[model samples]
Target: MRPPKPTVAIISPALRKANNGNWQTAHRWSRFLRAGYDVTLASEWAGPTAGDLAPACLIALHARRSADAVARFADACPKRPLIVVLTGTDLYRDIRSDPAAQRSLELATYLVVLQDEGPFELSTAHRGKCRVIYQSAIACHSHAVDSEYFDVVLVGHMRPEKDPLTAMRSLALLPDDSRIRMTHVGGALDDEYLRAVQALQAQTWPLGERYSWLANLPHAETRRRIAGAKALVISSVMEGGANVIVEAITSGVPVLASRIPGNIGMLGRDYEGYFPPGDAAQLAELLQRASQDIGFLTRLRQQCAQRAPLFAPARERAEVIKLVADALRPT
Candidate 1:
């Protein structure tokens, strides 16, 4: 028999139950790495115990949330590779203020950002080790859209970072006769959001008739919804790179995204589908334009189609596997 495969440990702060981007990335990466390495997935990393072999490398998601594990691993295995994956909060917020997040960046043998714009946030010292690994989704057949309504799907939890309220508010700004419908798929994280969505849903005509909140569907179901919609709206104020964007593109659906660095990175700067973050009126204008102008909507779809190949699973899988293989190779 050949030698046993080397072990790899993946530390993800959010797991399957969270059903969020970090979890999706971790779960997908685990499946990709399993063919070459023995993989263990968990929220935290405890050092090896009696007779337990240490992982050849540790890949941790979210520099801030996984800082403790990264620190422990660094102290225990100073010579081994430790990879830290930065999330939106880590890159746009915590790395600038949080000591733990900063320390994780310094201790990491390699740093990964999910989009091209991520490295610009790093300091000169940290930038040298940073790399971009665009996330991917398998292509799903596009379902025929209902001409009665121009359905726009938004997938993200109810949180300040996601800025989901912006999308909801935009629905009210649409024209009285606008056929644009907002279908939101995410659970409210707090009572404030719960109340906000409930209030919107309870309203008459424009808001209530046009808005539908599914509140956290399964991943497959969410993808199906995205594939069936006329377009997807991503209203996040911060994102390391959204998996939903990839899902939307791969499903042959266009995206109306916020003008944020992470989003600009995934969808090129020239792409015709951006609205200012938190600007309800602007988002409303884009949504209304998309609904009424077939040529404009088709333009957005064409632009998204151009970028879809970059998020293909084959390309992502190769890049991810190469990152690991290179890290484990003897220097």
Candidate 2:
């Protein structure tokens, strides 16, 4: 008889309704681990109950938000494996000051970061346990580009960390003859940010239609739009790793990203497509150059292609499986 498959619970603060990166990651990992283990996902893990089957391993996302669950799981089953996945806020902000976040790091048997640059953020003691698992996306055939306008699409929620207004402000700085039309796709997470985007979109442009804020679209539709655009822009002030970056690269679309650690980690430290975070003037200049200089766009595409292999589905699956297996192995 075959041995029973071990139960693994994936705790994600963001559920399916959230439609965010954490939820997407949880869902993908569940699928990847299903064949080898029995997996379940929940917003919180209250620890094993009398009638419930206990999980052999726990994978929790977002240290601060999932801290309570991590603590309970650790207390309930001290010998069982526990894995904590860190996010942008957790690494760049919370872990430094938040006690709960720090506890999660200390409790975890292993740590997972979405990009290569993630391990460097941890202290020397924690670095040995950290592993980089770059997110993956299946390749999508590029749609026919609309040559009538050089379209640049930015996909991310209108949150403070994303610094979405940078893209909006860049529209006004584009050269008078530049044909770059910017599209912003993301749901407004902040009321003030929504108003700011609305105000920007309301202004009349001397160059006719210059920007459109398309709120949020379905994931499939968003990918199609990304594949069709001339380029994708990621203007976040901070990121642990971004799913949109993987999606854009797999779709054969080049990215113009902020020169932050997360973006540099995914796009390479020397990638030519970086603009200083919040620098609207420099972003506008790059947009103009990409539209006018064929060589620039070609170079961006080549760089993106070089990084595409890192985000392949098979690679991600293998890494995820190995991480879990290592965590569950006897110490």
Per-residue CA lDDT of candidate 1, range 93-178, in tens? 99999999999999998999999989999999899999899999999978955688899899999999999889999999998899
How would you encode candidate 2's per-residue C-alpha lDDT over 131-209 as one tens digit per residue? Answer: 9999998898788466868998999889988998888888889877778988888899989888887787678774337
Which candidate gets the maximum TM-score versus the true structure? 1
Those runs of model 2 whose alpha carbons end farther than 4 Å from true positions after fitting are none
Q: Clashing pairs in model 1?
A: none
- For every candidate in turn, the CA RMSD to the true structure comes to 0.8, 1.2
How high is each candidate's TM-score?
A: 0.99, 0.97
Model 2's lDDT to the true fold? 0.91
RMSD of 2: 1.2
